[model samples]
Target chain A: MALKGWKELEPGVVILEPGNTIEYKSGTWRTFRPVIDMEKCIHCMICWIYCPDSCIMVKDSKLVGFDYEHCKGCGICAHECPKEAITMIEEAKAKAEEAK
Target chain B: MVEAMVKKPIVKALEGDKAVTEAIRQINPDVMAAYPVTPQTEIVMEFAELVAEGLVDTEYIRVESEHAAMSSCIGAASAGARAMTATCGPGLALMWETLWVTSGLRCPIVMAVVNRSLSAPLNILTDQTDMMGSRDSGWVQIYAENHQEVYDNFIQAVRIAEHPDVMLPIMCGHAGFVLGHTLGRVEVLPDEVVRKFVGEYKPLYSILDIEHPKTIGAYDHWDYFFEHRRQLFEAINNVLRVIPEIAQEYGKISGRYYGLVESYRLDDAEVAILIIGSGAGACREAVDAMRQKGVKAGMLKVRCFRPFPADEIVKALKGKKAVAAMDRCECFGGEGGPLFIEACSAFFNRGLPMKMIDYFYGLGGRDTVPSEFCDIFRELFQIAETDKIKPPLVRYLAVRE
Candidate 1:
């Protein structure tokens, strides 16, 4: 629901809740997704540092996978991967491959 | 609050820019970010000197551009800090985008704008062009006629902008060279008095409150945009009542009362001219000169341009035979200058009957002498007697053909 008046605004429109952008579902905007090859991965964490969307997920002191729900697939992660362990895959092909 | 004891200000001779700096020193804001531009350069410079001398404690950041200056103020203001900045003419033009950003976000940042003419021929003179350009940027605009008012208004602005009902930024406008460079007497209040009067700023949402973290300037599409704009309108409209109340409170201490409009000898007058800023001083003289000749002439100086005192103006000019609106800038392709259009609208909305004329004077800092004001009153008198305005109701005063 949209705010209808000044009563709805937090004076000066300062958003009262933070880190809720995860609800926006920016992954729906991606035309391509990055796939990581675990064999060649060195876990340099460069992708974690360079992601513009901050959608890279790392758990238990290791790079697991991208948070596809929020990532826009800007390819910065693949480009920044020092070991060339990541590859760009078309979203349509990735979805079909997932079915197999 | 009793009327028995009131503190009067100590008088001192200071230039217009110095007076504003003196005001800022008394307020002692949390953050001040600014880029130096001429006419207003001295204000930032003096403020910096105060910072260096340990006379005031403030986080002063010298930004690279006017845009960044205002951007820094917005950032500081968003964090529940009292923030302010100053600029003029071209510098203000550079800050155009962020001006809307500051106002749209409802940041209560105060700006001291030394009014100057915009350049095509590269003139660095004084006029109302810069301030008029931002008429709709959602900031409350207050014009000061002299050095004292410049100091007084800046102090009052701190309260007005932070008022809960009117949480909008304020622009304290001083005519460049006219008041900015001239030296005059200004009353300086005690530092404690100003601090008490302004009180502490309390933002409705503080970005620094990590316990309830928040974001500002988030994206909003059509559905929410109109409502947010409506908030700005309601906030500024509240200024019509809030400003006078604040001024009256200020009057109790300083003995100087400010109002939305200042009418001089307008009661029972047949013809009058509406003016703004320092030019009103000359028009007042003209009104007195005309009175010597038994020509019922008067003057009305618009002290508050934004949230304009439309109803008061209509009441002041009602039943008057003729009125002339004098402007310092030209609104090309418009019906008349900015003030002219606004004044006419005020009357037309109320369906009041009166003959009105528009005149553009003092462009690029051209001097408008008393003789010119007398001529305008003469033409207004003719309109009053004949009930007919001279053709081309708008004319440029003291301009070469």
Candidate 2:
């Protein structure tokens, strides 16, 4: 009545749970670079609300945001921001060029 | 996982995705089911075209959706035929339910999920979100950094997934735009050589036959669900046990080494950063740069993500002061990312490192340079050696308080 092992599952059907041998790079090297426009910026928490990695820093309903640590640069916040206040940029090479 | 399978070295140049197609072609799967999306769509299209040309004699199932692509392949594979499908993002998400069923059934079908972005705006771009989201499915997942590895992994994936102890559907991946669309020169071995690499499907059961009648997708009750699941667990735990045998066999056929974890600068590392997917290349370049500058940073690129390789991870980072779990997917209130959460939970039974910080980057095909990786390692080393500093919820470039 009950299937016990590989035999009972199906006639000669191999019983396996699942195992992944391949590994992905930890978040694809996120350096959150948020772009905000002060002119069109209307204070809204939509970006904050939908931050997948929650890298936004908000105070007094005004955007004084930083990439902090977990910023994956997913650009979700930038994409969702009602004010067009954020544009995601990569910090790896861009920042280097800026320092140069 | 590279091997010299072809005896005749009449090599032809091909792309990574093309190489995957060729590898699957050589494997000679019975049913090839696929849907179109970026990165991976090219590979599937190439294969579909291969079918049309009669270059490979196989039933090509052009499914309407990715979910169906995986499902139809599962049916074909369940009936004791080697089967495959390719998808990414929404396609991968569509196949989520079937992914569970295939693994639970222990069907050794092969699928490739070119990592791509999920959507609200319905962007048809690249990201690891889909595969990371389906991380729970009982499927073996592998991430390929470039074309060479993608070719090698595709060939190796079938063998590993089909192994008696590791009977699960497989999804080998690469960065969609980076590896998928990149048209670099790849060697296309003769069909004979590839044939040698992938011999035949040694299915546990025969395809729909009059003699061997049994049920698939059957009902299992509360009396023994966990027990059924435990058998799958044993298969995962024991995969490493038989992997070496397969790797050794592969080495005999092909010279490339498919290793436990590709370690770079890990010997004297105070901080070990673990990278998965194609981004490992960036991490490797970053490690080299760090080494040149006298920084004691090392890297462990995870070649396999499923089977949860806990022992391998713990052993790799055991004595290291800290480990950074870089993930492409965000984990909301949980750890910084999915890889971080999975790796953190993994250390429960081992002497895992104390400090772990997840760095997110390159969603939707953004380029991640070596310098950013170096800065991440620099920040990671400082965090590991001293009092731990909490990671900010959102870290953006130029958004410093």
Candidate 3:
């Protein structure tokens, strides 16, 4: 029955799972994948500098695009963009957060 | 923090990184130093959006490094503003030496740490090792399990840290990869509720006047410096009483109460568990399996580990014969788990024959299935029954098979 390392936190407190009410799933809408329109965009990297998640990328010294991996769909870039270039679409619309 | 707001806006599915932005929008925080990290980028981004939209009446300081992020906050807070900043693993690690000085100077600054795993090895998972390592920096730390707790902790930390009796800085961290990414139904309490919860800030030392002359953080030799440390310890001791009072007062309005350690199903159990961060979920699933098998068990979630909570902990585990300490980070050669060893020290002086087991699991997002957890508890119970105690050390799941 004993596996090895796992134990109760105290005599009764637990550091691992104890029951079936599993509520630990990351459902959709937690992600905000941003699409960058290169044409309308001025290379204003305000979003890049201000992003708390660092989900955007500036490649080869040019503002290439956004990184969906860590983007929580906060949409601050779209809101802060001067050119209206970055738009926040749901994660289901394009490549997922993990793929990047 | 909510100053004369008609009502609170609806709860939005926000990230842990975004809590600062929301708090700024609601509180209209006077000054903020914005820095970006992998997971915490959302925080600065949202605040920038608020600044751009003109939604919140606040000034945002766009800083370059994590050091500047905290530096700006320290400067702003001292100049009589509700100042804030955020960082993850490495970024937070960079804010190190400055943090100690900020608190020692008695700045009641509030900050949100998007908890991420530290690395020379480079892993971006959720772990408390970063924040845990900073526990000695004189900042009061509160750990939130979900997005709602994330929001609530920020509101409470500002008031608690700024309280006159406890003019220590506060650091409340959220599990970056989980709550940071987990969008869920978070009920936004009405402005009335929040206002009632986070009362007016009565700053004891925060004063700004061009005409007046004052001195702070002056050069002190060993004679004066030694007294400062003693005085600092006395201030911290006041927090043990102050924190509980604030939590109880906040509970009346919000209908939610948080204590130093949260206990569930531990009253009549023979075995107990301990953990912080989001790893408590794994233990919950495993405990159900043990219960079905007729193993009486419970859990004591250690949300407040710093003030040590010795009395509450002793009350929680006084009768239990075996306790399991789960840790996400190793203690190197010192003990089985880092948090485990810290909690074990509480009991060491008691001279009671309690069997404390330490397990290092779920580090770097290693898959912690419920079955694996159940096996750990079974192993701990076995050790207890046989009256055999292994060396107080860290045990890895890889060693089990």
Candidate 4:
């Protein structure tokens, strides 16, 4: 989003739109990204339940993938996975592999 | 407009505290959260009795501390309620942190600050040290000269604070003991007239609105904090224009006019005194006495302090030969008091070379007689005649050498 001038800002900086935090992409603050191993076969949805930012995606009561746009890359989901089905990878390494 | 012209005022003898209480009764705000502090206690106490009697449908919260008092007012105001509170001296000090938060969040809360001396020496008396301390906290500040102004300013404060152009909190201050404890004649408007004048408080945004959920006091990082704070600056500057318009509207209903700076016999005077709050009455008396004695003396009373009324003040003092800015409180290590410094700065900014000086008096509630003001006027004449300003630009008035 483009930065607003002083006159364009609302009085008191009140957020008029609900759930506008999605506009602020906190994923940019992530030093590490969580990679889930769906093949490990536990769709218990523990990562979905433990993701603090609600970044874990789930459909039909089964875990799908991570919504990295809003994820702050806190390792809570990877640590909470009882089946060890998630791993925290450095963001730079993940991007390097993606580039390759 | 026609109805307001025909509306009659109810004349009553009441102390300044009671006068404010009467105005609050008429405003009948939605919420009042206050704690007891000397000089300011009577206002809330009387209003609480009225609340118990069901005179006004207001939720009066007896907060434990002044901090909590202001905090609760902020909460209620942000929730789209017309909220108010009263405090003085140490109580104002206690509410220091919340004062900034109140304006920063743009909650139009009105607070009656009975001016009193700060502690350490520990005195419960009339002085402007308390409100002057919070002058830069982004709240609109209006001072009253007597019981009538105390009553009138309180009513006007409601509209000024809640104005859409200035969604900022305000502090209406009156001298603690001088006005708060003494009886004076005040002509109050009928309850319905006041109610109609202030009208309904329509908040820009309310937390209670479920259909359009809005977040109040959200965190703003570096990317937007500067812009938001700049908006607050613009809002307060808007007050400089909004106050006079509202005051004019209030004048039509009450038959009492108010301005940012009240110029008394200032047009043809060669020497003048600039003061604020209750001292203005005494200064005016001195100005009248000087005129009777064939001396060209005048006075300017600053009713609104926060917006400073720099242009109006400069215009008022433009042709004067000499002027004195009398302060009830000292600025300690600074060259002069807040009012004096601001006045000098205003004159300097305009490149007006009129001789200006500072006078400190009535700090711990010492009486400032009309004769003492005459002494200041006499000194002004001396400066004007000789064109020589002595050293030690700040003089102590009525203080034992």
lDDT-wise, the better of 1 and 2 is 1
A-chain TM-score of every model: 0.83, 0.58, 0.61, 0.89
Candidate 1 wrongly placed segments (more than 4 Å): A1-6, A35-50, A54-69, A80-100, B1-9
Pick out the ten consecutive residues of candidate 4 chain B with the lowest summed lDDT: B1-10
Off by over 4 Å in 2: A1-100, B1-13, B185-189, B385-387, B393-401
lDDT by residue (B81-178, candidate 2, tens digit) is 88888888888888788887888778888887788888876766666888888877777787887787788788888888888778777788888877
Off by over 4 Å in 3: A1-100, B1-12, B398-401
Question: Ten consecutive residues with minimal summed lDDT in candidate 2 chain B?
Answer: B391-400
Candidate 2, residue B351: Cα displacement in angstroms equals 3.7
Better of 1 and 2 by DockQ: 1
Selected candidate, larger lDDT, 3 vs 4: 4
Q: What is the two-chain DockQ of model 3?
A: 0.01
- C-alpha lDDT values of all predictions: 0.89, 0.73, 0.72, 0.91
lDDT of 3 by residue, A49-96 (tens): 878767678877678876654566788888999989988776664655
**After best superposition, candidate 4 residue B378: deviation in angstroms?**
1.6
lDDT of 1 by residue, B83-168 (tens): 99999999999999999999999998999999989989787788999989998999999999899999999999999999999889
Candidate ranking under DockQ, highest first, comes to 4, 1, 2, 3
